[model samples]
Target: MTPERFAECLASLRWTAIDLTSALQCQLSWIEAMEGGQAEIPEDLARWLESLAKCHEAAGIPSHYRGVAQF
Candidate 1:
């Protein structure tokens, strides 16, 4: 994903790594790697993040708060 877009997602999520990891059902290290752009975001992780964002939106979060995803 474009770095800017990734940053946007992070911002929307309020930098809550623990919460995001729980939402994505992944380890915090995984989320940290992806957010820090240290590890290449695999397709699965990308999909996971997308699904998590959708879930958040469905739970009454604003759609506009969601960000574009990339692998």
Candidate 2:
């Protein structure tokens, strides 16, 4: 996914760069760079986001709020 998409997805999931860093076990700087459009969204990170979306779906946690993901 593009950096912009990654940022959007993150907003949808109600996650901050700090949260993603913890979840992905990556450096906060990495997440910051990705979200700030200084770096590309890695393939693995995109896949992980997709998996998180699926988990949210399975848990019956609404994925969006007003056309944006809220969880």
Candidate 3:
């Protein structure tokens, strides 16, 4: 996925960079690189994020707020 799409997924999940770093057990710089287009978001990782967003959607996490997703 593109860096912009990665960032959008993060926003949809209401996750900050720190939250992603903790969850992925990776360095903040690595995530920053991904978000900044210095690194590519892996295909598996991209698919996982998409699935997570789907889960959140299916569970009505964002249903109350329309396009806005809440953690």
TM-score top scorer: 3
Which residue runs does candidate 2 get wrong by more than 4 Å? Answer: 54-71
Give TM per candidate.
0.50, 0.65, 0.77
Write candidate 3's Cα lDDT for 1-71 as tens digits: 89998888888788988999999999999999999999989999899888886676667553456768668
- The segments of candidate 1 whose C-alpha lies over 4 angstroms from its true place after superposition are 13-15, 44-71
Best by lDDT: 3
**How would you order the candidates by lDDT, starting with the best?**
3, 2, 1
Model 2, residue 20: C-alpha shift (Å): 0.5
Question: Can you write out model 1's per-residue Cα lDDT over 1-71, one digit (the tens) per residue?
Answer: 64455556656556577877787688989777767878777777566556755665567655774685855
Question: What pairs collide in candidate 2?
Answer: 64-69
Candidate 3: regions farther than 4 A off: 62-71
| Model 2 per-residue lDDT at 44 | 85
Model 3 scores a TM of: 0.77
Q: What C-alpha lDDT, on a 0 to 100 scale, does residue 46 get in candidate 2?
A: 94
Give, for candidate 1, the lowest lDDT window spanning 10 residues. Answer: 2-11
Between candidates 1 and 2, the one scoring higher on lDDT is: 2
